[model samples]
Target: MTGKQHLTGKVEALEGTKILCVGDVMLDRYVYGDVERISPEAPIPVLRVKDERSMLGGAGNVARNLAALGAHVAFASVVGADEVGEEIERMLGNVPHLQASLVVEPLRRSTVKTRFVAMGQQVLRADHETSAALTSAAQTEFIDRVRGLVPDVQVVVLSDYGKGVLTPEVCRAIIDVARAAGVPVVVDPKGRDYSLYRGASVVTPNRKELAEATGENASGDEAIVALARKLIGEAGIDAMIVTRSQEGMSVVMASGEVAHLPAEAREVFDVSGAGDTVISTLAASLAGGLSLVEAASLANTAAGIVVGKVGTAVVYLDELAAKLRENELSSIESKVATLQAAQDVAASWRARGLTVGFTNGCFDLLHPGHVALLAQSRALCDRLIVGLNSDASVSRLKGPTRPVQPDIARATVLASLASVDLVVIFEEDTPENLIRSLRPDVLIKGGDYTVETIVGADFVQSHGGKVAIIDLVPGFSTTKTVEKLSR
Candidate 1:
């Protein structure tokens, strides 16, 4: 069955999209440890800190969000002249292809939110900053910084934390200039006034924010639709996406078309920065030319990935792609089997219109070369079956001293690999009988052997199965491994 794995192609298409993220950025700090007992002075749990880490938060996170998805992201924002500001600058430099045009205002204090966590739960939090509105001079300079980058960016993201960096004037100036340049704008809005983000192409607000902004508490679809339309008309915004907690997301377009995506039913470990994940994914997806509905769907998946982690987590493109692929076959263990059981499994894979491939080896001692072969072979077909040589077969082929690990151990190890879907023991020197019975669509071997010389190649070809050979990782073999152990 076709599944989310189809989006892997779309992820690859996100490479090189230029995204400009502008908004209030913050320094997110984490202190993790264990809480053994209550504190002596207070009734709170005593946390003995063991580790400390920090990351880009708020708008800086939006830059990471785009970079994580393989987009070229540049951040434009304001920071105070402090140690937290220095740390943020250093970390931003470390991110791949991420640049920033930051205005360091002397009067402002850099925003820093430090959380004290114990056993993966937040025990306490500390905030240090000023949320006062930006001065007229600062707002003008901020707009100048963002306006200079608008023409070069494919998408402009205004990530507002209500931290005063995104003043109404700054927001209007940036949106107007960006729109004039034909660049679409996305906003993670804050404050009660929807007019601040009037010209933005999309405004993402949480359920609570949506209610507070519109002063409506009706939870039904009709009520939410009515409220969203009211805001869209009054604010002159193009669309609104309400990120409802547990109830899922409702996307309302100015054209009165609404699309809702159900909340992913999974054990959410933490909801920190999930909104950042949503906006970043939306920005990248939109820059990649997906429709509003398509972009939200992809953003929804990205949010699902982040909330499963324990902190203000960001989803990487490769990890998201892998998750989609893994979702295709939920029960992978069902694919592993012995010869008799493999027949039914192969039939099941075929019935689902999936292609099957076969490979065989003694696999007495697994190494990267073996792993590479299996991974590469699996790429050729949907299902991969590893024909393992039994203990007797190994002794006959390698010598009495061989079959070091035994058949069961070798089979278990091979089956544990993500690429090897099945492991079937074969007593014969070759997998001739097994191949003839399964008749896989393709037979794979290491590049060291030719198709004519590979065992079962002729039979596979006679049955309309093709032979494939993959390049081996250099300097990797059981012989070399055993030689090192002897020393």
Candidate 2:
């Protein structure tokens, strides 16, 4: 697909999608150590500790991804009234646009997963958590909290790690409230009892969980598909997503259609929080206006970017964009994949009060006029995406010999500039559609065109955006250069 069509779905997925996450929250602790030699007492290797750190995990990881995606996230979970819980709240508070409805159950312990890493490999892991159900009072409080937020939120995400926080009663109550309010609910379910998530709009379970839940581990693909079909029918759910480690994800829709997304990560390190990332992104995108297929594709791309790093990790938009830029541009599928990977990062930057400026041109040759105009555009925004006309488009606008330089060469030159955050090629006659899809905060043109004449001026103005124009350096012009050289 072309750049225009590729980014259409992804861009639509960012319009005021507020998400509420309710489930298990855990602190991920990593103990980094060095193993030098074997101990004389036994055949075990001794590891000398160097450092330690902790991060949010499980449902908390889902919250992190939601925040990273620029969603208004309200987190509801159970934690002990201890120092660990205090630290977790502090961390949550530090994230922008995050709110919490935390319940302190004195008897329950905060869940924590501790991993020992030596020489880039995990040696062992220890989990500290409670698996017992919450008390009736606690469940009531959880339901009330969710009910209060249901009217404002667009979607609810339940991240179940088999921890005690997500009891059956609490899940049902919250789901009922969300349903009554006409909001969607997604669940990252665990264990053999999928019935707990019966009324959910969608539930994500891995291959193992699905097999165990339906008692069909050793069945064929048709059997698994049939079982998933049965579960979706019996539970009255809209969809079911089955996450297969290397094989990818299979999405079964209520329409009896199934779509499979092939995994795209080049490298895999720690798969700890990958599931949370996938489910969180999927729910947020769907709430934001993307179709189920589009949301699943975006989630798959986010997962691909995270597994390349170790431990529980989040994928930033800039890093993802850079990765996309490094890879070769091919079909529409590839372009969409790249954009999905960078969607959240771009949204986060926008949330931080950063203005995004966009401009497009043939820019066949680098001249002082081009430099001065680009520099001025960069001054108005935190980042710029320079759209370049394709070879065919450039040749059509100018003559066949007018370019004198290839499109790739021009793109390479533009990409090297410090002001250019991203470069996309358009084969069309005008960049009106591209600008409209991007919906940049500022639209910049080099010449003295009136704001009304700008292709995307109406869109920019409608969204409280502005239009800017920069004067060219008097002595320099690509046309002038070509004329002088010819003479």
Candidate 3:
């Protein structure tokens, strides 16, 4: 495949893959409020706390990110016998498509990072944890869990947070097992000594971590590559990625090839846990069979998104896909047309040996569920055509209060999505006329419907077209959103 097509294909290729993440796990707590006045007794500000949230941190964050990117992650970590540990374990258990093997160390305390924020900015941070190395027994138990996971996982991520969980012995044991299993190991290295991570496939470090590990001043790319190569040599790893915040990230391979990916332009709000985002994206991309450069580029985009978000956030598959499609917007713009224009495009696509899929909806209020449906629909075919119900048809089917957004606006939004190739608006109550005109190779619907019940199903079948049904995302509907607003 061409390089550009290969890179874009990675987004869809990341689904349903399994990744194993092993390292430090922590609970992140955020306290949001407005700091109005100064305290009378002390010199600190008197803040009115408004909201609080807790999320997976450290290695756990990496697992969450992998899950968000559509991978089934096996997370193995060591917690403690505290309530925070209990809470985090319960939370991790609820993460969809993630299996956890959390071993508890009675002598240690669970790691918890508390951040107090005001005006979308962190004011103070507190930590409750231990940095003591694991006992020999605990280390062995943890390594065994990871070794067990290696058989099922396509890639292994050593998400080190400098916590005692990833002590040298644990790192070495996991790497050896993974290497023996023929699984690629991606280490988010911690501490100054890179020797612990020796013989791994790749290591990811930020500018600060890279500089600290090698004591190399990163004034330029050549200097950074020179220093990163030094660490790669000493650690015996295959490659290194040094992430520079605004200047982007660099990939230095052991074979003396260096690649630089410019940072995705984003308005940074908070950079909390962006490093976790990087490693998770890198591992997922590599597991998706992307080249090292493609993986680094995808990781850079993911990190840029996380830094722009409000708090510790993940890069979802749809979000990343949308970002990747932004580069192809110019090509998509040419696909928007009327009935004749859409027919022409479909003929051309068929001539190129492409399978065309068709799905239609009012799409008055675009939500994650809609995006998910479109994404899955596109995955079933080479090209997808979306038939949008015009404003009058939407009002006729969905009532007068329907179509929260106008037809033109809705069409624009639908066209912008990556899963869509061409859009044709129909004035009829159903997309039957449009379907007959388009003659797509496949007809798709997001709802559970039988062939006899779906609109234009017989017509499609009579013309030898296949029908596909993708289930709807639960708890999401335009009517529900409007009702919630009214309430």
- The digit string of per-residue lDDT tens for model 3 on 54-117 reads 8899999899899989899999999998999999899899889999999999888999999987
Q: Which pairs in model 3 have colliding backbones?
A: none
Candidate 2, run of 10 with poorest lDDT: 331-340
- Residue 374 of model 1, lDDT score: 95
Ten consecutive residues with minimal summed lDDT in candidate 1? 327-336
All candidates: TM-score: 0.71, 0.67, 0.70
Cα-based lDDT for every prediction: 0.84, 0.78, 0.85
lDDT of 1 by residue, 334-402 (tens): 444557456645644553446789999999899988999999999999999999999999999988888
Deviation of model 3 at 171, angstroms: 0.9
lDDT of 2 by residue, 211-253 (tens): 8888876244566577788889877778988888787788888
Measured by lDDT, the strongest candidate is: 3
Ranked by lDDT from best down, the candidates are 3, 1, 2
